[model samples]
Target chain A: MRMLRLLTVIMLLFSVAPTITAQETITVDFYFPTATATITNPEAGESIEAVFNRYAAAFEAANPGVQINVVYTGSYTDTRNTIQTEIAGGGAGPDVAVMLTTDLFSFIEEGTILPVQDFIDTMPDGEAYVADFFPAFLLNSLDEEGVIWSIPYQRSTPVLYYNVEQFAEAGFDAPPRNRQELAEMAQALTLPDGQRWGVWLPTEGFPIWLFSAFVIADGQHFVEESPSEVYFNTPQTREALDYIISLSRDYGVMPGGTLSWGDGPSIFTSGKASMLFHTTGSLTRILNEAPFEVGVAFLPSGTAGEDGTGYGAPTGGGNLYLFANSTPEEQAAAWAWIQFLSSPEIQSDWGAATGYVAARRSAWELDPLASLVARRPQYAVARDQLAFAQKEFSAYRTIDIQGIINSTLSGIISGATTDIEGALTTAQAQIDSLLAEYR
Target chain B: MRHHNALGSRVADAVTTLLSLLWLSPLIFAILLSFRPPNEPITNGNIFFGSTITLDNYRAAWSVAPWLTHYLNSIIFVVGVLIVQLVTVTMAGYAFARMRFRGRDTLLLIILLQLMIPSGVLIVQNFATIRTLNLFDTHIALMLPYWGSAFGLLLMRQTFREIPFELEEAARIDGASLWQVLRHVYIPLSIPAYTAFALVSISSHWNEFLWPFIVTRSESVRPLTVGLSKLVATTDVGALYNQLMAGTLLVIAPLVILFMFFQRRFIESFARSGLK
Candidate 1:
């Protein structure tokens, strides 16, 4: 009699709950870059994966029979490698993946990723969702054909990080506002005894990243915004490279070794260096880790942008792409997952939790970020710098061309080779050949 | 003279200990740094400061990815590959040592030549082959290339050759079959060689990141190395030194623990199975 009662209850539950048949279950493989495994907040190290899980749970509860698998594939580069390998190996990999915005053209060339519009155009709120992204972010997400290929996820720009105590001792009330001021200030703060160095820009980081900012501040773009023409051999570029080499070469302010982009923030916090020119993505990390008060300012402009808003720092970070190989059901599920992640509420918390600037303007008006800005204005600087922010080197083969330019710069700075013009000339020739087919 | 000799021996021990510590410094730093807090200054070159320590990094690292699945997958992957390797290597080694065969010397030369060929040189071909076999994302794909290890073949062949033929002859006279002779005589005495080979196989597979990363796309097949990297390695954000080290420590902890418990067998196996 007890067994009969249990069987009757089970039947009723199945009838009411809507039985999920195997084929009807939509499984979305969501692959994204791993930035903060834990919490991203400057004050509280929040578990980003936990937030993703919560978002996944909410989406699951609202829409029955759909499962979201949030797989944190290594770095942005790793995400690209995984996607390419799967597609080339003839396997349908993650339904959705995130990679650097500069990877758009490269993916387009591969012909593996679906345009975000493919799914967005089918949604009721598609138009508004498309319009909601900040124009600055939209600049990189859209291709030359005006078809949007990706959605801006975690975007950022480089800024100057300075030590307040070191500045006071150097007798400067304000951080340097231009290249000339930077050289003077760096000279004042420099101590040759190895305990503290003046100013250091990591030559060992990503190719064509921070140095591109200097090119923009000098009123020049490294590659044409559309990435068509070669500009490495120009006098303008040579000037920018000379100013960089002069710091260690003629000025004696920076250290003489190959410094890595990753080592910048750590070196600063350890009081090994006084100033660091690094990404605003590191703001939260520096705030949380540094024992001293940290001050941040716009990167000093070159002579061209005397007003300091000259074609500003280049933006660099991860953007979302829809995999083309997924089923219609999987794609639909992936579209829903993208919407949930890109929603204002979720993006707002994302900005506050992680140091990344929210991709949409509306997210800035939302609660925690709005309050975060009010309480700590330092958090808002990266977003404010967006007015001047330009897209990084996005070309047919972005990393390759940038690598050539980077290795050239590295040679000049490290004193391994002295002829900057000779190096740039060789790089210019390589760029011309690399871009010939693209043109 | 007695006092001087005692001092000389003490000096020699101290010198040897210092050299060992020097060789082990990077490992030591990784272990110690795992305990340090994120807020502590690690690059200031004072890694030994014990002002504050926390298990928060471990907690944070654990929550990032599915570590439980990774642990299970890694154990199954290494052990499965090792077991298959033992059987194949032992049998092949026996064939080379005792059995007469055609073109045996030429075949041995061809197999030994594989030792000079780096695994990286064949990645593209291996990947293509894996796809053709329809085993692209499976753990079996990861184990396929490594199943017939050239180094293992060489090691076992050398070990088998050192064993006396009298034992096998004695067993055969008792009317035992060839299989029975191997089971009773060769297998029992070659424990150290097998143990030594097993250690090498386990550690190599455990730490291998690149191939597993290429083959496995989902969490179901990911090993601890890939999982830990996904947890801590971010492009935009710099690594959380403590958390990264903690995750690394967690990934390496099992191997370290195993080595500690089986220190004697591990050392003896390698010493007795010294390179031919």
Candidate 2:
């Protein structure tokens, strides 16, 4: 499966290893998740891996003596754990890798990744490159010290997806704008006798990000932006969880069970639910499979009587990171590769290939993206939602902290527990201990 | 046989058939689901059989991942791990079963202790060890941790012990060397145990995902289970049940085919292994 890549690596090591002149062959390993195992499953053309390979070749050819090994590490967490394990073992991982932006603090604590600010300070025109991306997309990348730790890559957000035909049948011309209307509309849409429900909030899959949308809608950051603290026991978190649980318990709008994350979109597309909340990453799946018209909207806002801006989503997905352990030349090469990958041209291509939102502001101006948005329009919803997006919920011990909150939310929403405040308190306790060292 | 006994035997056979079908239902269901067209959402009814059946999902699954590469990697990993384990376990089992040595019982106790310690519990240390050895991103990394298998050693020891002492004695008296006696006598007679161990080792390594996933940085070294995982990564297409099932069926196809071809031998080996 990796014979081609391995040969390239070997030839690259040979080509660069012995070079003795001013061209000090910078060998950089760029780790990112591949959408397919297609080095084995090589498709016809323009697959995500193909695009990256093309970029790697272009970068290598464009910069003589700089070789890029584009390694397809399995997933975001897989890459993070791989790097962390290596770091813990007194070794360096990939020169550059795609780290989950939510894992910014964990990576910072490990002291394994060089802040992008370091790269920017040394690289030419790096300021403009940093500024080119949508500011909302950079919110998670920036730390309290204002060091940019990462660059957005394949970012996404959750959105409200509804069956437009069902909406029309229910006499609604537009999607719900706030929590109250959503409840009322969901009640009207649900027909248990007809074997259909109103709405379903997937209990398990990326529940932390999904809950972030809820907490944001209620007008509170789920955790402090400094990544030093959490606000899980606040009114916002409780109100959000209660509202989620109430849909099943109080309003009877959604079913009371942990609807598997994998089944969420299919449940909607199958006409089992009129509306579902999920990542905009799923836009293609919904559009292709829906038997009827579908509409995409920002997740409805909370009933906080806000100025039409209470709704927000967590900016989700991986970020490009430079490993701290790489040599100056390799780091410089990594920075160059990052710049090439993050350019508006590639970002737009990436967004189109995968349903991730284009991370750069300028990407929307590109032709196919512009035309695609004009036609499908739903493709634009995740981008539009970015305006209201907060940096995704992040803290020290990011995964475990979120796991605590997700289990609490899932438990309450699924009727496994009635104590929202108590669950939040337990989660808060566990996280507090986990982050105590940082504090 | 008496009528009652015959009737009871027939009834037991029916029950066993029903249980086997129940056990096999998940595999059957996955295969059936793989035949579904992508447009069709999986439902309770679709589990029986879909209204619209197509091999489109299989084509899509095959085109999306390199199952052949995964198949090759899996074979390499399984065979590599097993070959190493066989040599190590056989020698260790011979020493424990026949030769007298100090701390033998204590050593056996320690080996058995590993059987109690879940492989997952050692993942962090093993990962650290792998990284330290600079074996990350290689198939050897996947094999290193399992090379000294405690269960295999124990299974071999039990099998060697079960071989009549008179056989080893006969070989030794015939002027066979220690290695020769063990090889000619113990190894030859432990066919069923060897088969059982081979079966267990192959399937276990074939199905292993987590450790291999953690170790492998690229597709060349990753096996079918890891490749199948990419199918479910379903970043956007959510579950894509048809495609997922298709990929899963393809991953286990080699094993299933092996089982089908070697069903009698497999059952016979296990039955004769004295496993109980």
- Per-residue alpha-carbon lDDT of candidate 2 for residues A1-439, written as tens digits (9 for 90 to 100): 5999999999998887667643567778888775333222111234456677887888788899888887766666666766766666666688988877888887787787788887788767778877788888898898887889898997888899999999999999999888888999999999976378899788774577788887777778877566778878788888887787788888888877777777887889888899898887777767777889989998888756346768778888788988889888788778888988888887876777667889998988895577778888999988887888888888888888888887777787667787766877888888788878877
Q: What is the TM-score of each candidate against the true structure?
A: 0.90, 0.92
Model 2 lDDT, residue A131, Cα: 79
Q: What is the lDDT of residue A317 in candidate 2?
A: 78
lDDT (C-alpha) at residue A361 in model 2: 81
Which CAPRI level is candidate 2? acceptable
**CA error at residue A329 for candidate 1, angstroms:** 3.1
Q: Could you tell me the lDDT of residue B57 within candidate 1?
A: 73
Return the DockQ of model 1.
0.46
- Give the CA lDDT, 0 to 100, for residue A308 in model 1: 61
| Tens digit of per-residue lDDT, candidate 1, span A1-439 | 9999999999998986665465778889888777655546735444666667788899999889899888766777777877776666667788877788888888888888889977777778788888788777777877767788888888888888899998998798788888888888999998877677889788874647888888877777776656567577777777877788788878888877567776677778777788898877888878877888888888888878767656468888888788888988888888778887888887888888887889888999997889988877888878877777777778878888878887877777677877777888888999889989988
Off-target runs (Cα >4 Å) in candidate 1 are: A1-20, A42-45, A118-128, A169-171, B1-15, B42-47, B53-59, B66-69, B120-145, B217-221
Instruction: State model 1's lDDT.
Output: 0.81
DockQ of each: 0.46, 0.48
